[model samples]
Target: MRNNAPSKHVRIVLADDHDLVRSGIKALLSMIEGVEVIAEARDGNELIALVDDLDPDIVMTDISMPGMDGIAAIAEIHARKPGTRMLVLSMYDTVDFVKRAVASGACGYLMKDAPPFELEQAVRSVMATGSYFSPAIAQRLLQPSEPTVDDELTNRQVEILKLIAQGRASKEIAYQLGLSPKTVDVHRARIMERLRLNDIASLTLYAVRKGLIKP
Candidate 1:
C-alpha cells in the first residue's frame, strides 16, 4: 500500500447490489492504505444518498445494479455531484458499453476480469488526474465497432413510431397496421416505454432525431 493521500484521505463510495461483488471491491481497495471506502450502496438510490451524505472523492460503481441501472446511475450521479470522479468497473467490455459509460460521465472504465493490479492502476490514475481506461477499453477505443443505424426496436414498435410521426390517428394507425385500437394504444405505450419518450410531441422529436421523419 502506498501513502498516496494528500493530507486528507481520498474517499471512495462503492455502489453495487451484489454482496459478493461489493465485498470483493471493498476488500481490494481496503488494501490500498491511502484510499478509504467511506460508504457502500446496494442500489442507485442509496448511491445518490451516499454521494450527498458522504461526499466521497471517488465513485467506484458497477455498471449493472437493481432499481436504477449503472448507466442511469452514472448520469444521475454526475448531474447531482458534478465534481465526483466516477470509476466504472463492469463485466461488460464491449466498445458500445464503454462508449456509453464514458458518455454518461464515467472517468474510469475497467472490466471486472482485468488483473487486480490493472484495477488498482486505473483507480490511482483516475484519482490523480481526470480519467482511466483499462487496457482492453483503450484497445476497443482504437478499434471501435462501426456506427450502427440498425433499429433495436421491435417491428411493431417501429410501425407505431412511424405511424405516430406520420400524423396518423390511433384508429387510423390501427386500421393501417391491422391492429385493434386497443392494441395500437398498447403499441403506442410500448413505443414510448422503449424509447423513454413522454408524449406524441416527444415521440415526434425522437422520430426526427433518428431520421425516421423529416424535421
Candidate 2:
C-alpha cells in the first residue's frame, strides 16, 4: 500500500457513501505525515473493489455504507486480506457497532464526530498496536449492560447473531450449526427484522448489547 504522493507514503483507503464526507476526510488525511489517501469508495461494494485494485494498507470506512455496509466490508476485507488494517469511523455511538467492528477485524473504531485529533490519534494507535477503541467506545464496551432491542429476538436468534458478530458468513454459520443455509438466512432475517437492524452494523450493535461480542 502506497499513498498517492511519493514523498509522504502511508497508503490509505477511504470508504463512505457521502461525497462531502469523503472530500472532508481526504482533505484531512492529506495533511498527515506518512498517511495518504490512495483510493476512495462511495459504498461498500466500491470499497471492496478498490481494495482489490489498490490494496491500501489502511482502510478508513464508515459503519453504514450502502451496498454491503462497513461491518461486512471489514469481515470481507479481513477474510481476504488479513494483513490489511481497518478503522471504522461512524456517527452511531452504540456499543454494538464498536464491538462488531473490532471483531470483524477493524483495529480502530471512532465516532464520526470525534475531534480531529482523536481521529488522528486513533489511526496512529491502530497503526502502532494493531488495535484501538476510543475512550467512549472502550467505556461502553467495559460496561456490563446497555439498553438494546435484543429482547425481540429469541435465544436461538441470539446465538445466530453472535456468530454474525464474530464475522461468520451465512454459509459458514450454517455449516457450523448444521442447518441449511436457507434456514440460517431465515433466522438471520428474523433477527434483523425483530431488532430493526437492516445491516451488519446494526446487527453487530445488537450482539454487542447482548454481550455476544466485545468492542
Q: Identify the candidate with maximal TM-score.
A: 1
Q: Residue 205 CA error for candidate 2 (Å)?
A: 13
Clash pairs, candidate 1, are none
* Predictions in order: lDDT: 0.78, 0.78
lDDT by residue for model 2 over 29-76, one digit each (tens)? 777667878899987788988998888878999976644678778889
Report the error of model 1 at residue 129, Å.
Answer: 1.4
| Clashes in predicted model 1 | 0
The Cα error of candidate 1 at residue 161, in Å, is 14
Q: For residues 51-153, could you state the per-residue lDDT of candidate 1 as single tens digits?
A: 9888888999886665555766788889988898999888777676677678778998988888777766877888777799987789888884743213356
The lowest-lDDT stretch of 10 consecutive residues in candidate 1 is 146-155
Error of 2 at 93 (Å): 1.5
> Model 2 lDDT vs. the true structure?
0.78
* Model 2 TM-score relative to the real fold: 0.68
